[model samples]
Target: MPAESAPVGRRERNKQQKLERIVTAAAELFSERGVDEVTTQQIADAADIGTGTLFLYAKTKGELLLLVQNSHYADALERGRAASADARTPLDGVMALATPIIECNRVQVENGRTYLREMVFGDPTEPHHAAALAIVGETEQALAETLSRLASIPAAEASALARVVSSIMFLTMASSDAEVDIAQIVEGVRTQVSAILPR
Candidate 1:
């Protein structure tokens, strides 16, 4: 008979539990007071793990933010995908896909902008940063799929346009002043996207 896979050992289970605690602590702290206001030691203390153990999970505050934000982004994208399905026009579809993501980013504005900065400049070799990039890729793919609803646009062009749309959304989110509300950001994205798409 073939050998069966071994069950998770004690050490591995402990490590997983530690990681979950770290993420929970970080997420709550970051959401309560922007990422700029929180420290690694605070997260470590909150997680009930030593600072050394925290470093093993995420080397920097930025990486910790990535760990916390990546899941939120993934969830927002799923919502966008679902919302897009009911849209009647390409522009509407694009907005449907963009709206939830915009809402997610605005949840903790500073954290959202910082997360974008980290995604662009962080060490891609790091797993959390890589996961952030993968989410971006998925967002673009989803946009491309929405854009493809226009019969005149082929897959290649749709993808290129999607990249432009992605840039518009990211820039609008990242560069907007903290006082700028979500509606303004969404409108800015909508205007730019409408300009690029065929009538």
Candidate 2:
């Protein structure tokens, strides 16, 4: 008979519980006050853990933000993917894929912009940062898949176009104009996307 897998130990469970608390606390605080206004000590206090313990999970506030926002970004991406399935054209599919992400980024505009900055500049050695980067890769992959719906677009070209689309989306989101609403950002992306797509 095959050996049974061992159950999780108390230590592991405790660690997981702590991580969950930290993520929840950070998410709430970040959403309420924005990442710039919330401090690490406040997060630790909200999570009911010490600052030292919190540091173990995320060395900096940015990593904590990543831990919280990564899940949100992943969910938005999934929604976009589902929405893209019903699109009738490549432009429609690409916009359907990007719209949710734009909304997600605008949830708290500064926080969204900070998350993008961290994704670009944060230490890749950190697990949370790596996960954020992986999500970006997945977004590009999804875009490429959507673009490939055009029979004329080969896989390589589709991938390249997807990168361009991804860049457009990110740039729009990370723009300095905080007054730009989700619709405007989406429209900006759409126009750029329309320009690049084959006629």
* Top-lDDT candidate index: 1
Candidate 2 lDDT over residue span 110-171, tens digit each = 89999999999999999999999999999999999988884358899999999999999998
TM-score of 2: 0.97
> TM-scores for all candidates?
0.96, 0.97
C-alpha RMSD for every candidate: 1.6, 1.2
RMSD of 1: 1.6
- lDDT score for residue 25 of model 2: 96
Among all windows of 10 consecutive residues in model 2, the one with the lowest summed lDDT is 146-155
Query: What lDDT does model 2 reach?
Result: 0.94
lDDT of 1: 0.95
How high is the CA lDDT of each candidate model? 0.95, 0.94
> What lDDT does candidate 2 reach at residue 166?
94
